[model samples]
Target: VSGNYAYVADYANGLVITDVTDPRNPQEVGHIDTAGHANGVYVSGNHAYIADWLNGLVIVDISDPSSPEKIGHFDTDGGTRGIYVSGDYAYVADTSNGLVIIDVSNPNSPEERGHIDTIYACGVYVSGNYAYIADERNGLVIADVSNPSSPEEVGHIDMGDKAWETFVSEGYAYVADQTNGLVIVDISDSENPEEVGHIDTYSALGVYVSGNYAYVANHVEGLAIIDVSNPSSPGEESYIDTDDLAQGVYVSEGYAYIADQTNGLVIVNVSNPSSPEEVGQIDTGDKACGVYVSGNYAYVADTSNGLVIIDVSNPNSPEERGHIDTIYACGVYVSGNYAYVADLGNGLVIIDVSDPSSPEEIGHFDTDGYAQEVYVSGNYAYIADWLNGLVIVDVSDPRDPKLAGHIDTDGWAHGVYVSGDYAYVADWLNGLVIVDVSDPNNPKLAYDMLWMTFYSVFGM
Candidate 1:
């Protein structure tokens, strides 16, 4: 509420407009529906800009308080959670979508202006039009995305994570700690992420958070669901047993897609998270180690089989749609029709999935070190190059993907997640290492938190 009227973006409901003439009694004056869940709102002279999670931005005209109406909307490829309006643009703290800018000169027709692709943007605060992003492992990052088309980072809060896997959601990061079970950190102070909670779960390999629930892919015990509403005290709400070993997990819609190593891809109905029931299963003919779901398809990193695509549109009955060959495909990231595969032996293998029935390798960049995980943002594809640290490749030219930059980490880089201008590396023995990738051409090491100090000083 910046002026006469107070604008509210409801998470469950839509946008709620209220008349706050008098502080004691704020009465609802007008309202409108927004796609997905409305997570954050910003008020301009007479317009209410809403940051609709997954659905993107929705502009509502409130010039006539009693009759607020939607004027325009722009869909974002990544998840949007927070927003801020300044001058003639709106800055959005979009997860994976990074920082998105919208030109709102015409209140009735807001259009996409510019964006900075990031893998883990916590939250965004704006002053003088410049956006301040709370970036997890990288800390606080100051960016001038005012010129939408060419956004750049001016400053950053550097720190580091022997973090196994990392996931960013609504200003917080959940990590599967092999040594600590589960670790939750608050990235609101982008420059200062503090450990907010932890839980023990024997041994954890991967983790995913949906709503208030954090799903832990336990190596030997299966899957563990934790209630994270109270970040300071995360409580285990339930646990479900799975076949073989659960190495990775991806939650989408109402199902938990698990990369059940050796056993292959396993699907469980999580609509009722506590009691997860196996609804579907796909034996990829190889060890399933990584999984990612998009639309109605499930792309799997079948260790020996290379890339295996499955049709999970029918959750209870998943069928193999296609398969492509690559060398030790361990991690994957799909964007549009291209599937970027982290081939340990061959390097970055780009497969054109325009036809899911037959994915073809269009291009590849043979990289150094053991490629573990990958995250694609904009034209760049980031790889956690084992001992090589962070490897940034220019993928703008899909078929001609080339190495744009590379940064060596302190430890063996096992996993990597990018948000905006920084890359959070899960450096196995070194812990979590944060690198500034704003200047992709010259990736510089910001800082790293070494849990195993002995390994930090000595080569492992």
Candidate 2:
């Protein structure tokens, strides 16, 4: 809880509000019923946006945290899931319909701006004047959305397997390519995106790039580090074998924190890029899937155990500080003093990690599908769902998360990452997926790369 307001979308329960002036204690303020299942939420000033599954979009005025009133809505022809907001437009991931852009200048009356049909449209982000869409099997799609009402497809690149999510930075796009591992693309030219390099982890699900290193969460291979100093020729630098299946990874300082399936939380020292070593580890009993590090502590998604906090002041000896037992935790990311956990079947769980030794669950967002991975940037949390694809939620109000926008990539989304204005995803068998999340609400696909073969003759 950062300020005086908070919003949450409680799947079948609807949207809920709370006052979080006191980080330790959060009080529920209001609630609003939705026609369909609520999955994601976003709060902008006095308005709260929601991604209502079968019902499409739902808008509400949250000026009065205790009494939110519905203002307007727009129903997409297909299943409404993920969403993002930028400028005066809202980007939506409508199941099989690809990407849908809407004019939200009039909060109460959102009008369809434009759309690009693709495979499974999951998550989106807007950067500059372009939209990046995570198109599951199809890969990353970059669209020129200077004119929201007439968005145009500009470029695309498909990674071998299903692309669950993506993150773009410094003219490069890092993607989570399910079984194909992590892929890096050169998006310097949005209209002619190309695959500069890639690191295959066999079954990697999520990825994050910080500085010259890229951290990947390999389901069974554990955490992998790749040196991307040369974008056109990126190569695997090191590997931290957690033993347990790794799902999500986050880097802070010189350490890489990983979410391990059964080994719980595993911390690696990446200061030596060539010799990345496991510094600390903890077993949560439950399946540890996602992780994020902040200050001296590390937050982990302990699957059925909810959220677990560990002290990382001594990277070689991380001690369990606190934990919150919730439904099914999957992904986790930390910002400020709060740790956001993606609770698969339970939705989103927000906890106050101000006191690492005694963390507490402050709030939650119960989306319809089973949330897989999560990425936090600015004020939003992009969630990848196995069934529904990608769902974006506003965590400005840690306790009460609101739906901003969403995209439904047709495949089974496993992981997500945000960079610049793009979101990358790792879809099971679909390959690498990219989405333009610059607009936040309305994201579009740019490019895709299905399969690339490289052969070499040994003893000719």
Candidate 3:
């Protein structure tokens, strides 16, 4: 929040600038649809730095609040969760890549200065000569960033709990420790920061310190206000009660197989699309990211669990048949007897699923960008490779699939579906992008339907 405008990194809508001069009646002034999912935002001077998930850091010119424009971007190796802009550099808490410091002196061309790989850096707070990282399960990690080009970890605290975000103020660091709630630490000594106090709250995910109060954004609970006037012992001043956020669904036969994230794979009788009813469910033990239904079997791209095959011969009682773990399965497409998976960072992975009880990896093709979703057509596979856009691969020879062609879309490609000679891509905020795939080796943008409201498009 700066002056009378509030810059929000709205996940679904991108960067939203609101007129908050009237707190009781805040009004949205303008917004810009970013190429990727906006997870966090930091407004500095005339620009707004956005931590865009897979697309990395996106810099927007907000000098005109009502008409924000994308000025620059720097793609990171890992998912960008939070961003903090200080001086001429932007510090990013890149999930897998850890703390990535980018020289954003030139907003139009930001460059990576350096990075420190930690367990899982999610959020970061840079103050004076130190940077505090909320390293998820790794806890609070303190780094000496007196030199942006080569920041080094000076100290760390392992709570064996998930740290989502951090707020540093007056020599003290407040952490939003998910299940562990809010934890206070003394950062006066950068080399030996110690936990000074803590208070359990319902799923604390964000924290902000103002004067003697600490505001926590909790998942299950609403806004929790803690009185941190005394760093050694904090007390809950007040609390209010909150709400929640589907990956993929495949309709076949008379049922629909849904990769329902934490809920796992859900089988719904969708013979009547208008009035679908839940029929069965099976816990995939991990995030159910995508699903492909073929014949009487259901193939699930169970994120961390990899590819999971379920015997859905009876929609009423689906059971696990066999499974093969891949790098990071997120999307699956079954063609003939092969199960093609869009394995996040690992790209395309083809598995022989001729025998449902014993699946075998047969081939794979490493893509240039993050693989999110895939659609198989004829002897070719069209992949929605995040920032790299629509990547076309020839799977004519299942033993060794090769890249055919690709077209960089206007936005991040998250999902794709092929029909006839055109491939419909769910290009995040850019909406539905239609690609001409008449020739597998030479794909082109047929049309970009940017007005449509779609996240993941599918063709029947």
Q: What is the lDDT of residue 345 in candidate 2?
A: 61
Predicted structure 1, TM vs. truth: 0.63
True-structure lDDT of candidate 2: 0.72
Best by TM-score: 1
For candidate 3, lDDT tens digit of each residue in 245-307?
034445566655666667677776645433456678888878886677888899999987899
Better of 2 and 3 by lDDT: 3
Tens digit of lDDT per residue, candidate 1, span 349-459?
Answer: 899988999999999987766678888988999888775677899999988988899887745677777776777777755556767898998988766654321111000
lDDT of 3 at 108: 100
Q: Candidate 1 — which residues are off by over 4 angstroms?
A: 1-163, 452-460
Residue 43 lDDT (model 2): 68
Candidate 2 is scored at a TM of 0.58
* Candidate 2 per-residue lDDT over residues 1-460, each given as its tens digit: 1146556778998888877565346688788898888887866777777888889989888877777798989998877677777888888877688889988999979999899887877666666577777676676677888988888988776645454445567777676666466667776766466777866666766677888877777777777788888877778887767787776677788888887777777888888878888878887768776666778887777766778888889988888888877777776777788877777766777888888878888878866667777778889988877556678898888888888887876445666667667666555433445678888777676543333211000000
Q: Would you list the rank order by lDDT, best first?
A: 1, 3, 2
TM-score of each: 0.63, 0.58, 0.51
- The TM-score-based order of candidates, best leading, equals 1, 2, 3
